[model samples]
Target: MGISPELRSLNLSNNHLEGPLTVSSIPLQLQSLDLSVNELNGPLLLDIPIPEQNFSLEKLLLADNKIEGPITASLGTMTSLYILDLSNNQLRGNIPDSLGNLTLLTVLRLESNHLNGEIPACLTNLSELVMLNLASNELEGQIPKELGNLAGLASLHLEKNNLQGLLPLSLAQLSNLQVIDVGENNLTGNIPSWIGTCSSLLVLMMRSNNFKGKLPPQIGELTELLILDLSSNLLYGEIPNTYLNLAAMVVVNEDMSVVGEDRHAPSARRVRPCGAPSGARSRHPPNIRGITPDSDHNYYGTCVDYVYGNEDRRYYIEGLDLITKGSERHYAYVLSGMACIDLSNNRLWGHLPAKIGNLKGLMFLNLSRNSFNGDIPGSMGNLSQLESLDLSLNKFSGKIPFQLGSLDYLGYLNMSYNNLSGVIPQQGSHMITFDKSAFWGNPNLRGCPVESWKCSPPHSPLSPPTIDVKEEAKEGFSWYELSMGWSVAAGFFAVVLVLTFKVNWRKTTFDQMDRAITFLLGERTN
Candidate 1:
């Protein structure tokens, strides 16, 4: 195939292109190449013919392909590279330690591959690194303590690996970190208290691990935290009411500007398309380099160039997996505006804080499979934005609060397998939509809308007083009956008095009575 030596960018993604990619075919001047979502197979050959010093490639995306074999150390020679994505491929073997040489690198993604071995401590050498994703690999061993050196790191994803040992203490140095997912690993030990020091944290997931101990109250200091998932662990102790300090969860209008402000913006910054003439002015302001500053570009930093022509490829970077509505759901760009707390499948016990209602912006809450007891906070009705709530398999007992009937946005609710009793709330449009399953296992609970369980009707001021059958039978007459008899006798006396005083009326009545009596006598004689 013939190609222009001046070519600076080539995007042929989502095609049926197959066979091994010939690194030598890439142009020396190429600054961006995106061949993602294709059938490209065979070992990735980074032995490009161009001299490393002259190579201008700044972005390389080969995700979602059939590429295999260990990453070539030669890749580190691409000094100008800032974005490197090889995710969702069949690549195997250890991540090349030489990759640390890419001092200008901002994003490095090698997830969803068979890469093994301990993470190279030298990776911390990339002082400008913004995002590092190495999840879903065969990696083992403790995370490197040197990682704290990457002070600019904003997102770190190491979930679904064979990692072990306690979280590194150095991580507290990451003041700008927004997301940290170390879930589904063999990590143990209590969650570090210094976590609160990272005040900018937005998502913190450490579920499905062996972590045990009381939750640190310091976590409540994360006023900006949006997602907090510590589920499926051995953690015990009641949740701290200090969680009410999560300011981001309390206000419906979240400050999304914090998502990628350090490196990019959630909103796409307009810029010239790759290969656009350098002298040409774009309709929007240019970003660092010619690249459009997008959350996907600078946060996940996937090597896709989206600022081309009429196409605005704003991609949501998958950041979390949360169990919602009885299934695991992937959260991506919307994570910025999402507020959720999942502490289910633990040994936590106690009444939820009534102040929890202060988190009016919370959207998902799961406290199932715990030892929590006592009445569900009626203050929960204040969560006007709540969409899903799970409080199943607990010791909570009491009447479901009628205030819950006021939640207009509640869509999924599960309060089953509890010690609850009394009528299920049946007022809100959303609340009435729930079936009996929502209140199952609570044998004491009764009401319509949950099932045909017999429940006493609510009292009304206009309703007549109830009568006791046994008492009425013993007395032979009720107050209601006595009142009726008195009314009849009073009417008779009043009529008698009126007839006696009014002689004309008295004569009229006597004449009518005499005529009726005479008619009756005649009929009988005949």
Candidate 2:
């Protein structure tokens, strides 16, 4: 068996082994041991000189186990230790700085534990250290920028800590660095350009801080980069055109203005921290102010690179800051594809662009608390895939376009607190579930007004006249004109009657005329 005198390595990972683990066996030729990802319990109580028995350890990993108790300072007894991983357990107490005495250690990982206190500055003296991860712990104080002196460092993770102050300017010296994550901390100051020049760098996360200033333009040159996130910072300046080519989706509250097709700039709004605001759960892209959710986007446009500081959603980009400018003119932020973008509580301005339909894949779109104006674009109907859309607290005007009803996937809609008028688009699932609160403050909006409100009923369409007088007259004259014809006929009969009566009067008058001559003088006198 390999457990014999000439045996070299031992591996026992991903098993259900539990209980105490003691090294009391006679075998001493082992050089490496891996007992990770198990339910093993109890403290490491190796008292014997395991190293002196020819079992000089070059690597020792005991992660994802139920190991407890403080790291014994006696760990330094393994003077030849080169790699050590004791992560993913309930290990408590401060890290034993004496472990630094293992001058040969090149890799050290003690993450996901209850370890507390300031990181031992003596760690800087480990000139041979290559990989270090102490994330998701209770560490405090400023980051040791001196660690940048480790030119050989390839990966580092110090997130979820209380580290503060500006990132060290010397980090750019890490030419061999590939991955770095310092999010969920209190770090500040402008992102250094030198860090962007790390040629071999790939992944970087520095969201959730007071860091300000423009992103470095040179960072676009990182061809091997796969992920980067610098969201939720107090950064400013337009997003560099080079940054548009990256392919990632940041899961942080990094805020920036989508100034144009290729131009992005920093915003002034406060990005959500690693956590969320009160009464609101932390959502993807962190806790923003003016942004809302849009889901069920049937529009599947191109996928663009998202540079932010949060992890997850498959993409991340660095080299952009949002805090310096606050929330001025950050609207028209478009990253094609049917994705979710929550930009709440920002200082963005301008009407929503018509091209917004280009994001056929958008399911969630929130542009609340912004300075947008103008009629909601009719083209929005093309976004048949949208779910929840919030354009609330804006200065928009005109009737809410009916095209919104085409979005059968619509769930929650908040056009409230805006100058919007006309009927709120009535189609979608949220229509019945929502009430006046969803369209409040839109004075001209047509609908059954709330009982307490006194808005008038909507105007009705007019009915057309029954007959075209001119067309009817061409076929048959008016009744008054026909009556005129009858009047003429009656006039002819009256004329004939008058003529017959006149003959009688003429005969009498002729007889009277003879006597009239004689009586004319008397009649004239009478």
Highest lDDT: which candidate? 1
User: What TM-score would every model get versus the actual structure?
Assistant: 0.76, 0.51
Q: Supply the TM-score for candidate 2.
A: 0.51
What local distance difference test score does each model get? 0.78, 0.60
Clashing residue pairs found in predicted model 1: none
- The local lDDT score (0 to 100) that residue 377 gets in candidate 1 is 88
Tens-place lDDT per residue, model 2, 318-431, is 121122112222121222222343444434455666656544444556666656678788777776556667788878899877777667667668888888766554434234
- Model 1, 1-526: lDDT tens digits are 7888767779999999999987776777787799999999999777754454488887788999999999988888888886788999999998888899999887788999999999999999899877799999999999999999998787889999999999999999998786899999999999899999997677799999999999999999887677899999999999997787687787664333332332222222222112223223112111222223453432321122233334344333445788987789875443334678999999999888899999888888999999999998899889887889999999999988888888877888999999999877754334556877998999998776566532223353665545655698687777767888999999999999999899999999999999999999999999
lDDT at position 160, candidate 1: 94
